[model samples]
Target: MKHAQTFEIFLIAPPGLEQSLWKEARAKGFPSARYTTGGVTLKGGWEDVWRANLVMRGATRVLVRIGEFRAFHLAQLDKRCRKFDWAKYLRPDVPVRVEAVTNKKSKIYHAGAAKERVERAIAETLSAEISDEAPVTVKLRIDDNLCVFSLDTSGEALHKRGHKAAVGKAPMRETLAALFLGACGYDGQEPVLDPMCGSGTFVLEAAEIAAGMTPGRARSFAFEQLATFDGDAYAMVRATLPAPQRTSLSFHGSDRNAGAIENATANAERAGLSDNCHFRHASISDLQRPEGDPGLVIINPPYGARIGNKKQLFALYATLGTVLSERFSGWRVGIVTTDGQLARSTKLSFLPESAPIDHGGLRVKLFQTDPLP
Candidate 1:
């Protein structure tokens, strides 16, 4: 049997993704959980941590919930902080950081004071101190009215795939890009195109998927820092990350901006996907299908706020719709945009097929049209 220890795990995501995660957790066989804005809480262990990191399409961060204690006053807070088993997971040599969030009704009005108590507690109990005034080891987060302590198990944001050293402006994050692709039912078997391929995120992600790649394989997770973490198990995990088979699929992307095309090409090469994905400079007014393979057309066009011009933004979206409706008649389409109204200007009739999604603070939405005409 697998060793299972109950931890109060918190799965952090964008604001609206909580419900989706809740549904995902149930479908994926996680136990019942409590949820709030930006996250969900449940019981899990290191294996659960690994599974969540590797498999969860929606989760941005998986926080291993250490402990949570409540106190209305400063003295009470300090006394309670010292009682945690910080020693179990922390070491004296490893440095740490402290954070705190206080509610309106509490006497602990000063977040600084709460952080001090936790820092003192860690030093006294674990014989280790927090100095991430340029932190080295532990990280902390305090939510509204509550301090739910966790060690940062994902170091850099999960989206920093270390692949896209060159990026397009207003770039969508890798993890978010992956989740949205999954939401669109991209199985890596069909040809994929990005008409507004800013930075080539969709094309690159599609190429990686087609090549049977795991998004987390190329990066180091913060969990590797845990005192109880096992390296041998992780190596085994990494070794199994690649799929057994690869396929021949065309991932195509186009942008009117010459600079963006160059950046996309460089990023694709950096991601080891240059051979699988094709990047070109073309306006949405002229995007066309490749010779073969019926597939999905995914786009992330510039909204008014992103590009700062409303008329041009609507025109771009409108052109994107025109190309989709006329040229790519048999292809499926998925358009990601923050502006529902701007997307409305696309006038694709398939506009009703949209699904709302969230990315960090942004309320993102996907308008999907299909090949089933």
Candidate 2:
């Protein structure tokens, strides 16, 4: 994989949110981005890969396709892997892990055997150490006898973002929160609120987006350890990012748990979003409309699948609905939950439910309502 050559870059999306991730990629200036079953793909060089890791909020991780070949058998795969140019992307000094996945349609059905062959090739040919705990990873997918090799450029998942040190039970991931915010028509110009703000994921994400803060600004990437990495060039890329802007609008989050509020406030302070993110301890019944132009009110309440009882949650959902309906006029509502009955308990007129999304282990849907009348 030459540094100058453009190749396929894949952005892994959270199972059912591929289109949403693609939309974000396109809006971020990857005009030719296309959504596939599990991710979004585009053509880019190494710098584009770095940029994607640095700025893309909705991508779980970035993978860069280095090369591919067709191999019908293990011997053929071994021969091809040994002959392939491994030194172009991987460093001799850095350790790497090879992970392979093969499907029934492929003759190379044994993924473990394939992985061993590739590992041997890289170790012997490029002199790169192979370790199971390596920070850098080489991913291989063999389907229909074609082997595609990709590098996981983002070391930790992008959701880590290197800022939040605390999280609540059933917390929303930052990547999913960004996509859900986009689904609610949040363009970083309006206010956002989360009633059950666990560790303040939604509020902090909203404030960071509004301030134009790069998601990966505070983190390091796996690509930095690869052979193609250029420290001075990457520094220049980071330097060119637009300066964080100041915003007057405040993003609010409230929860009944005082500990949760403390965690949220600490998270905001760590992310440098304390200026625009306000967290308080309050229950659903005490939730009040913020004094501002009505923007968006999004919440990810307990689904009863992981916490609390389903029968008792009906009353909680009803109370949330009653509070929002009576107090939050002109504010759009986005509720994430696994049960249709719980969403309906709100009694707020919602637009059709979104396609089911995979969050944690549950299939959750975003139920949105137009601004409350």
| Candidate No. with top lDDT | 2
Off by over 4 Å in 1: 1-4, 19-37, 40-42, 55-57, 105-107, 133-147, 242-244, 351-362
Q: Which ranges of candidate 2 are over 4 A from the true structure?
A: none
Worst 10 contiguous positions by lDDT, candidate 2: 1-10
> Please, what is the whole-model Cα lDDT of each candidate in the order they appear?
0.72, 0.93
Model 2 Cα displacement at 311 (Å)?
1.6
lDDT score for residue 148 of model 1? 64
Cα-lDDT of candidate 2? 0.93
- Model 1 residue 38 distance off true place after TM-score fit, in angstroms: 2.7
Worst 10 residues of 1 by lDDT: 134-143
Model 1: per-residue lDDT, tens digit, 1-373?
1334677777876665576666656655577666677777778777778766765555777777677766767787788888877766665666677766665666677878888888888888877757764232343444444556777677667677767888767888776776667767787789899877888888888887778666666677766666667777766766665463556777898998999999999998887787778988988777877878679888877776666786778787777777677777678877777887887787775546444666545667887776825
